[model samples]
Target: MDQMMETKKHNTNKGQKLNVQPLRTQTDIETAKFFLSKNKMGKRDLLLFLFGINTGLRASDIVVRKVGEFRNTKKPYIVEEKTHKRRKLNLSNLAEQIDEYIADKSDDDWLFPSYKDRSKHLTVNGVYRMFEVLGKQMGRDDLGTHTMRKTFGYHYYKRTHDIATLMEIFNHSSQQITKRYIGITEDEIDNSLDHFSIGI
Candidate 1:
C-alpha cells in the first residue's frame, strides 16, 4: 500500500498521471453538475462534460468536430477523427437540450469552435481550462479535464465488467494500461477484499 501511494505521488508530481478524484459518489456528481450549471458557463460547460463523459473521448478529438459531423439528426453518430472509427453514441438524453440550445447556431460552425475563428474548433487546452475553472469553482482541487474521461472509463468498466470492451473503447493495446487508466490502484484491491466473505 505504501509503495502504491509513493508510485501515485510520483506519477502525479511528474504529470505522468492525473490525480483525479473519482466521481463515484452521488454527491460528487452533484457537485460537478452544480458548477457546470452555473450561468457564467452556460451550455458550453455542460456540453463539454456531456461530450467527454458520454463519449469517453479525448478532449482533442471532440474540440475539432464541426457541426456537420453531428448535424444529421436522422443518424446521430460521431466519426472519431483520431481512430477514424464512427461512434454511434446515444444522445437521447441531451439531444433535445442541445438542439434547443443551438436552434439558431449554424451547422458550418464548430461544435465548440474558437472565438477567433469559427472555422476552427476549440483547442484541447481551451476545454481543459474551462473544466479547470469549473472544478475550482466547485472547490475540487483534484479535478482536471482528464477526470471526466477517466470517470467515463471507470464507470463504463464498472457497468460492463469487460476489460476487453474497455480496451476497445479506449483503443488501448493492453489490459495493464487499461487497468491503470480505469483507476485500479492498490487501495481498490484492498477494498475488494471486503466483498470476499465466502459463506462457508
Candidate 2:
C-alpha cells in the first residue's frame, strides 16, 4: 500500500493523489490524543481525524490549514493550496478542535505546525511517518495518512449511497472509480446478507 502513492513531486500541486491506501482505524482516532500528549504534543485528534477522513484534500493541504482559516469569525470557506479553489466542508469535530487549539495559541496559525518549527508548515511525509510509527506501536500496521479519505468515502457512500458527492470531493472521473477508491467489495455485500432476508 505504501508503494502505491508515488512521491509527491510538485510542491505546488493539489489533489494529486499517489493512489496510496489509508492507514487508519477507529482506534487510531481514539488513542491518538493519549499518544500525542505523551509525546508532549497538543492533542488534536478531532482535527487530525476530520482532516484525514472528511475533506479529501491531500495531506499537503490538510496540514497547512491555519486554525483561523477554519474557525474564524471571518470565513465560511478557505482556499485550497493544491487546487486554489474555495473549499467548504462541515465542521463538526474540525471546528470544535480548531477552537480549542487556537483559543490559547498566540498566533492562531497553521493548524498542524511542525514539532520543531511552529512557523514552518508540517510536511505530508512528516505526518505520514508519525502516523506510521504510531500505527506500528499500536500493533496496527495496515494504516496510513490517506486512511481518512478512504474512510470518508467509505462511510459517506455507505450512509447516503451518493457516489457523485464523493466523486466531486475526490475529483474522480466516475462513480465506479469512487467505489474502488473506498475499497468496497463483494465481501462487504456477502457479509451483510446474513442480517437481511430478501423477499422471494
Candidate 3:
C-alpha cells in the first residue's frame, strides 16, 4: 500500500497543472454521463455533470449548494463564491431531473453530499477528481471541472451566436475574452484562413 501511495504521489506531483478542455461534442458528453452514472459517482454525479453544463456554475458553487436552494424553485439564485455576485440562474430546463433527485430529501441535505460523510457536501477536490477520472476514461487529457462551464459557454454560443448575452452571462470584461474562453478564437482563425484565397 505504501509503495502504491508513493507512486501515486509521484505521478500527481509530476503534473502540477491540469489542462482541461470543454466537452465539445454531444456524443462525448453522453458517453461521459452514461459511464459516470454506472460508476462510483452514481446519480449525483450525473446531476452535477448535467447541472454544470446547463447552468455554467463553478464546481465550488455547485458543491456547496443545498437541496433547499433547488427545491420548489425554477430560477434559483446564488451568490458566486469567487465573485461574490448574486446572480439569478435559470435551471427550468432540468426541472424534472432536479425535482426527481431532490424528492423525499430534506431541505438541509447537501445536493452533492460526501460519500463518506453525509453531513458535509463533497469537496472541490472530490468533484475535480471525479472529472479527472472520467476524463481519463474518455481519453481526454484536457478534462476537469471547468470543462462543464466551458461546455455550456461553447454550446450556448453555437446555438445563439450571441456573444453579448454570453459575455453578460459569464460576466466577462469583453466579448473577445468570451470568444477566447469558448474557443471561438480558433474558429475565427479557421474561417479567416478558409476565406483567404489568392487569385492566381
Which candidate ranks first by TM-score, i.e. highest?
A: 3
lDDT of 3 by residue, 51-99 (tens): 9999987778899999999888989889998689999989889999999
Clashing pairs in 2: 14-82, 22-146, 22-147, 23-143, 23-144
The C-alpha TM-scores of every prediction are 0.75, 0.73, 0.86
lDDT of 3: 0.81
**In candidate 1, which residue ranges exceed 4 Å CA deviation?**
1-17, 74-81, 84-86, 115-120, 190-200
RMSD values, in order shown: 5.8, 6.0, 6.5
lDDT for each residue of candidate 2 in 1-105, tens digit (9 for 90 to 100): 212442344223332234444433566556754565555454653456556776666676788777666556433576766567777767664666567667876
What is the lDDT, from 0 to 100, of the residue 15 in candidate 1? 38
Clashing pairs in 1: none
